[model samples]
Target: MKFKTIVVVNDFSFVNGGAGQVAISSAIGLLAKGYRVILFTAVGPVDENLAKQGIEVVCLNQYDILHDPNRMRAIIQGVWNVKAKVVFEKLLRTLNRTETIIHFHAWSKGLSSSLFSVTKKQGFKTVVTLHDFFLYCPNGGFYDYPHNKICTKNPLGLSCIFCNCDARGYIQKIWRCIRQVIQNKMLYQIDGTLFLSISDLSTSIFKKYYPNKKALLFRVNNPVALLPLFERIHVENNNAYLFVARLSLEKGIDLFCEAVSQLGLEGYVLGDGYLLDTYKKKYPMIKFIGWVTGVEKENYIKMAKAFIFPSKWYETFGLSVAEMQSCGIPCIVPDKNAAAEQIIDGETGFIFQIGSLESLKDKIVCMEKMKMEDLARMSQQAFEYSLRENYSMETHLENITKLYDSNF
Candidate 1:
């Protein structure tokens, strides 16, 4: 029952974020490994790489919930997406179920849980990549957005349902809760499905919410393309601390801003989000370079003293933290979530007390005052550790292919 075909499912065809990047990259890798691959997405002007690599793509050509102009339609489609269900079902019917694996990477942004019903009705084996906690938490991140902290309430329970946790408002929170209820129902209907976790911390957090006795889950490292050792960023000589993520509340942008401002140190933010204008007005001291990709983005990362990943929630895997470390630039992460797991604390990078500005400032000051010799040593260790543990595409492909084959 080895899988010969993989239908890679995500909300977007382009690399909109981490999940889309993983879905597209892995689909390409799977094709190179001789498996027939198809990209099934809800949003696109499809990425050129997929077509260039000869991978088949089936796109819905739609907008994600947040960006959709029609509010009512986005809300409805975010819950069930009848069109996606029908079209995806038509696609599945043409394939031999036993030979195809539905590798679902993301959905909450657009496609919704209806895709699950499609796979269930068609009797196809599926592997869900735990890119985030949307399968359990209503808002994807188990975060109290307004309060700017990690949430402990049981998801969808009375306490969880009553919390006004959505970034938009309480009404949106309730709507997302309704969406989660249907998604959970569709999730629990399938049996013998595999949940692919990207980090041990992500695996642990997921296990807490999904304690169903029948659930199957395991950790699989996300493939990080290690940078060439010769191309290492001379971060030890840099003076500015860097923060790269959506300028959102749960990401702890406020914490980064306050910490760097209070210390009067140079700080730079590399990404953009809805909070950009507000952050610019509030923290004029911190430089906010609007979202830039490719060479421009890498150039910003290269000028960093250290990456400040002050995520307030339990991250599934802070891909940027891993990328920074892999590039021989240490990251300063809070002592919570998967970002901390990527660092060797005090060696590769420092881990501050979660949500404590004082703790974060202490680490930043430590990094700021460190001798050049010590900082260089830390960079060297970060690069060496990445090579040993955080593997590249080849190893990632091998591990994933084994999972696909063995699951059958």
Candidate 2:
């Protein structure tokens, strides 16, 4: 039960949003429990925050592979890089075989699908956490290409054509298809797969395609770590709604902006994205605060009347929803996907019909009529509900340690 070394592989450094935060939190939790945790990432002049936390970060650039224009070359480097594979192998050889477990978060960006192939061939027990739909979908978001619409088509269907979901055109789609094939093959070698939310509708779609795999399935919803709650300072602002997610089409920000414009209400946006400039020009009244973190993020959550979560795709888990709930902020989310699991309609928060601008507008109008006391009560319920359902780092660490102990 005493694990001396634990290796976590992710796509990016931990200073970025949600996925990186998850990686850092889990690494910190494991380190606290006496594991020598090492993080393997593709590119990093290591994030100072992660370095300060005492976690060792290994970048893949130590390998002699130069960046390539061909997508296949990058994929090959991820799988067959002698230096990166040797670094991992050296760590494994130094540890007791029975006491080491490789926990992989993501391998999409730099580490190719073949990293899992190396781990499995070395006879190392491995676990992968599903962060997005990239494991099966070539686009990673289960969104149709060019149009940016939600795609419900089964990936294994013969009619499954690349939608060019990344907006990079036909060549990109072809490369993504190749990546998908590589990923599916590598997954067969993994010992277990963990989902952050139980409401993984896309994962269910994946199951129908590959029903014979013996991977152990575990759902440990992402933890919400927030600043300490303070006394409610109810600000009387009826027009103050908040949107705190990446400003992308799939996030339904376009619909949200249109709805707000129809309502003639001004709101605040707390993140930036590819659509930021476009939306800013279109809606001059709404405030864009461009990526607030820590105290700034905390205050924004506290000041908002209600947070809007208008995502169209099946999000793995709404990390922003959990963060809002922690700060006693109610959210108006769509009825489908993981948002349905997180929100208690008319109680903790409200649920609008998915992909309907009219329904979203109706919900916003309904919120305008609610008494401040009722909203306050709902906020309290939201905060309490989050504390009950979402795991804390301490609890998650204990659960994962138990899983490793019992399974290994």
Candidate 3:
């Protein structure tokens, strides 16, 4: 393979998010393939794992929108960070434009759309992975936090602008709309730019927003990191249903707790968020394991009867769903979102009606009644599909490398 320098852009140098992990994994894969790779971010002290891979990281060491305590400054920077533009411009100028591909995984965390405009202004061909819906929706998820449901209002429309869907409040919603305006002004920046959408569901959701001009769009599945199947035995019986995502309202954490409480079933929440204390107080029986990774995460999934992926938002891809499937664990997800795409219903796992607590509880009741032989068959099917399909890191690397080669 001919050596080509690849610039991977994201909000964080640390692998704390789905988009950031994908960006880091891709950079590492490129480096192993003998390509020069650079991870460009607006936040942090970098992850030691990236440095160990010999990939160069350029971080502005700025605070992300979530971490920045200065509310006014964070809002302003979220719209357009002039500092990021200046720093990124300098980095772009140093790289060989002809052999370099600027691939953006995320920008909503801190690096705003100004980075896109700057990349285009510098006359470099760029690629953006639609990790979320920030390019179209103001809050990223079309989810209405206040209402606890998905919002149908068009992006920046009168209704969308008026409705307070932001988790913070209406004031934050207004600021987000302002950011959307700034983002729209530079939508042309991504014109003729390649888009690496993580799922067909994401492409369908944002298809209307892509520039009118022809732009290459590739459907690249998120690479799931998993322990080899041969390393352990699959669990044939488990008592509790597990929820492993961030314990946020959009993740349907409340719904899970409610259903678990109603059914008088054992429920284990393996992640933490703002609503953790509130939910724990309301549902004392439900167990909260806080945040966990590696073996701890895998063991939690393995010991569960079925993994519950009740995301209320239109997730681009559910990494946890895929990870659980890899471990021969069935996942019960909403029939909407990208997680539903991974399930085969009665084969791999099950699907419940979107935003319906009753439907989820009924599914759990049905699973509890399932025969051991039937459950084992479904678990085996889930594992085989995840391992054989494009979800594996090997397949992700191959697809990315081919995309890179095509651009060259």
* Cα TM-score of candidate 2: 0.90
What would the TM-scores of all predictions be? 0.96, 0.90, 0.95
lDDT of 1 at 255: 92
Candidate 2, residues 345-371, lDDT tens digits: the string is 888888998889999999888887788
lDDT of 3 by residue, 201-320 (tens): 888876776445366778988787765555223546678789888888889898899998898988999988888888889989999999997778766766788889889988998988
Best to worst by lDDT, what's the order? 1, 3, 2
- Comparing 2 with 3 on lDDT, the higher-scoring candidate is 3
Model 3 steric clash pairs:
none
The most accurate candidate by lDDT is 1
For model 2 the local lDDT of residue 166 reads 59
C-alpha lDDT of all candidate models, in order: 0.87, 0.73, 0.84
What TM value does model 1 have?
0.96
Task: Please list the Cα RMSD from the true structure of every candidate, rounded to 1 decimal place.
Answer: 1.6, 2.9, 1.7
Q: Which stretches of candidate 3 lie over 4 Å from their true place?
A: 1-3, 211-213, 229-233
Model 1, range 106-211, lDDT digits (tens) per residue? 9888899999988888889989999988978898888987888888899999999999988889999999999988988898898889988998878887777885
Worst lDDT 10-window in candidate 3: 227-236
> How high is the lDDT of residue 358 in model 3?
91
- How well does candidate 2 score on lDDT at residue 347? 89
